[model samples]
Target: MADQPTPDTSPATGSVPEARIVIENCAVATVDAQDTEYARGHVVVAGARIESVGAGPAPAGLRGVTRRIDGSGHLVTPGLVNSHHHFYQWITRGLATDHNLFDWLVALYPTWARIDESMVRAAARGSLAMMARGGVTTAMDHHYVYPRGSGDLSGAVIGAAAELGVRFTLARGSMDLGTSDGGLPPDFAVETRDGALAATEATVDAHHDPAPDAMTQVAVAPCSPFSVSTGLLRDAAELARRKGVRLHTHGSETVEEEAFCHERFGMGPTDYLASTGWLGEDVWMAHCVHMNDADIAAFARTGTGVAHCPSSNARLAAGIARVPDMLAAGVPVGLGVDGTASNEAGELHTELRNALLVNRLGPHRESALTARQALRLGTHGGARVLGRAADTGSLEPGKLADLVLWRLDTLAHSTIEDPVAALVLGAPAPVTLSLVGGQPVVEDGRLLRVDERAVAAEARDAARLLARRAADA
Candidate 1:
């Protein structure tokens, strides 16, 4: 049932009636259990579920297909999944350009603290539009900053994702430790621990859908070890387990974070997280750049997953993550764009190339990562990290019709011999079409549901407003 689309009744979804779709005369890369690939093939979709995929033209006599798209000069693959992000940061890009992990957060915290519902909504709209147009069918946001009375920030983000027509997960993040308590964020930005927990629970109760075909889901997330208290971490783990939701947080992204863990709790980030009951199958942490062999072993042993953000890590001068070692050690790994503040190119396809290039700089250059492995990290690996692998990772019968048609015949990519290699190593390919739940989210290199120019203008205004408010305060 993986990749099954939600059977939505909402009036706002679109006007297109559900029907069959057949895409033929194109290549297929089904990142399935056996890594199936075909130089020329076809795919059939009935309503929201994939009906068939094979090496030749879609079996003849396919009936009732309202959409018959000739996918010549294109390669079809599973839609990319973004395992981690900060949608609110869409309006905060290009700031703190020369700072490392800690300084970058410190510099951006004030502006982020001034965000409200309106600001977050605009920012999220721009973010989701960019990703969806770039072939991301599923996205997740880790938003933690809650200034005193920012009305419904989570709702604002959720609404934007819905408006853009992409599967979404709102990782309800909180930060309780403030400057007064030896933490980094200003006191005014931090929420009361109890209040944060209560709000997270309520958000889950209201928005989370457990159905395999659900379009929206919720996760319990604390900001990070340095900015969130010990009690909060333990309690969050318990709450997430009780509610049967996944857990996410920042972990081991920098040496400074490790030093903080050692100074405050007499352990490294991974050990501290484990002591707080945060290491388990349902938990996926971002960065993991500074993990040692022991930490890798622990993550593999506990079935914990890691989200690899290569561009963000490189931008912030965070060390290269031990991705090859983790993979060899059996740790489930995925790719994340992190935040636009750290990685201005908030697209997932580029992450595939960056992940492949950055990991090769280390001692194990030969085995760091392969192009196919990189693609897996962006698609199936992300699904596994979000705890939804059984629902939306690969292209197989019975999975949701969430996939992309990359135009590899363009001038930039046509000369390359291998489609997969050209996609990962060559310049980024254009998305001819992207579908979410048997509907067109993007077509002909443009977003179908919203105006791109309008979205850009809204994002600019929101960023300006947030900056002014921060200055005024």
Candidate 2:
């Protein structure tokens, strides 16, 4: 018999071309328009884009790549998008755990005023890593606290995001009214109206990216009605519109805010916003917990979005938002983790779970919110609020490949019958891998871009120093 031909073992001898990544034998949850779920599927990624997705083997005609990722026994979905956050507050978590929103602000304002560029950058990096581990790929950070001569804290946050490789919408938040001016914040924590506007313009000019798939963008956010003058809100809105950016602010977060609006502006929160031309598709407000039917109608008609921070609300004893009613009213609603000092966590997945449970407390009949609905609020709905739905929030061709892969072998999900439902009902788990714009920033449940433990330690030291400085002041 003729000698059997030995199998070719050379590196380039095989005809089977390499794939950038082959997520094989995984359950794919494509949160697309049709809400399709692929069980035991494969995802082929090439150069930061998903080349193909289907069940079974790769097509024979496909060509070469470099890496491959086995995603068997994992659940893959579009990454969670956090619509609202204060990344700086990660340094103040647990400081005001028992206070309401108003009292909490009063207690923390002085400490927040002590933040420098380095401290703010450390906090931003820590927050981003925490959120990424929780499966958040895109986040909108409302960083409004700019102490006098702190040296551009907003730019520090942008730099941190760039280093972390997470898509960031840095809302240039401003507060113009100090306690002397009948605002909630102290004088040191507030800026002059003109200074705030100038800073807003400078940040927008320097960092705002209007193009699709932008990693960083700037939104003009005048902190809130209680801490910002009417001129600031209106000017911020005008500036946002003029620059084609978005506007964000805290509105109707608590009953105290309603009273403040009534006493100062002689109108409800939503009405005050409308009177100042702040209601529009280009605007999204955080914590609309006390909005009424008229307010909801106005939001719907004006195409204004709302960021529902359920965990923060519950923690602060604030009433639940009329999320179901707001959804029924056709308002674009997204999930927000709010400030870490308020909610004590930056986990976007936990926010989605809380959002589902809180919405059920409403009087609406039928299912309050499906797991899929909750997931949408975290992904597509949040993308809509940040004005990036067309480029993110869904797994599709031409969109930025921002996504998370979660291991399903955890005890919480051991008996889950539906992987999608398990995501919302099961206990939260750290993301096994997280990607933004097709770049892997987190792999194997750890951040690949930064040393998280070191940053966390820095944050702890910074927080202690801030506390000491604030107390001395």
Candidate 3:
């Protein structure tokens, strides 16, 4: 809480020491500087921190060892980070099929307007559980819809994340512009500008944690340019800086969005965002698929980050994000699974594959993105986007022990000689273990905190109930 945890090569800060857990005989992809890899290696976890990570066997005489694990058939990497998502849409999957970005938002806003705390709690629980099983140790959810009388929606989702045991960030989002003002969301679905700003500040104050190993944090997100007023966007950015939290929003995701920005504000998506003081080191925008050279340069110059959602963009017919170009131009880039409504899988691991394949379909083929690049995007790249790189992104001695053990020895993946290739290009590898701050959240490819079956059942019921509520309205 007082300082960024010291770099791993140094001693544990302060006086309190932790019980140690060791894992040996595994393939390690540190995802650190130099893209370090070990064909056979060991990782030692001490309480909530990593004690050491190295090749060919763990150091001997490790004291205070509580549990020793043999990671023979698994490949260990920094836990995947989901930089952008909508956990509330977990129950709203498979809707607005065959629609573009504009049409999709219009179709879904009514049902979203009907959401209450119970439904969102169930939905977020299910969504986080799914991502955890897929090896997501750190997750961020952007929940923007605030219907009248929706009691403690952010609290409900935050509670679910705590129960499931993943490091989480709730980007308490808002929409102050509606169809009446030429925005995509319905009039009743939007909140007043003052109300939105006030609520966002309250959420940050109640939930945001400045600790290096915090379980939950909050960001200020005002939906998107089309769905939020210019004043709201401008004020939201200022408020986020005032509170010392990060800012998130949708940008340049679709041709329609770009056209809307140009028509309304006489500028492109990136330009309009900058006009409102929304571009900077502390800001990360979702789905920068439509960015041009100038926009990319602006992002690079400002040290802004991008959350690339490959599958979601493809699902909604949003073009491929200029990920290769953005990375080349020095813009920080990370991966996002987006919302289950658009990306029903809602898993971070699959984004690695999707990002690789989708970018190959972009202007630069083959060299668009490699398996290692995809792995980095899901791991350390996302850490940078969420402002948690120093603590949780890579496998270093003093960093938080947030990582995943992918069972690459399974029949589906065993044939692939390279562990990283098997993980990225091959079939979905089962997660044998996933840890957040040295705590086990998933084991044997299932959620350890909550019953997976029960979570799915709750989400199913919530989805059906939500449909009824929307229909009645």
- Predicted structure 1: lDDT: 0.91
Candidate 2 residue lDDT tens string, 1-473: 01122232346754764335556667888778888778877666666667777776544444564445566667888899999999999988888888888998888887888888988988898888888878889988999999888887988899999988999999999998998998777798889999999989999999998888789999999999889988888888888888999999999999999998998879999999999988999999998999989999999999999999999999999888998888888999899999888888778888888989888887763478888888888998999999999888887766777888888777889689788878887888557778787788887788888888898898898888878888898
Clashing pairs in 2: 18-65
Looking at candidate 2, the ten consecutive residues that score lowest on lDDT are 1-10
Candidate 2 regions with alpha-carbon error over 4 angstroms: 1-19
Q: Candidate 2 has what TM-score? A: 0.94
TM-score between model 1 and native: 0.96
User: 209-319 in candidate 3: lDDT tens per residue?
Assistant: 999999999999999988898999999999999999999999999998888888889999999999999999999999999988999999999999999999899999998
Among residues 3 or more apart in sequence or in different chains, the pairs in candidate 1 whose N, CA or C atoms overlap within 3 Å are 2-391, 3-391, 3-392, 3-400, 4-400
Candidate 3 regions exceeding 4 Å error are 1-17
Q: Report the candidate with higher lDDT, 2 versus 3.
A: 3
Give the alpha-carbon lDDT of every model: 0.91, 0.85, 0.92
Which stretches in model 1 have alpha-carbon errors above 4 Å?
1-18
Among these predictions, the greatest lDDT belongs to 3
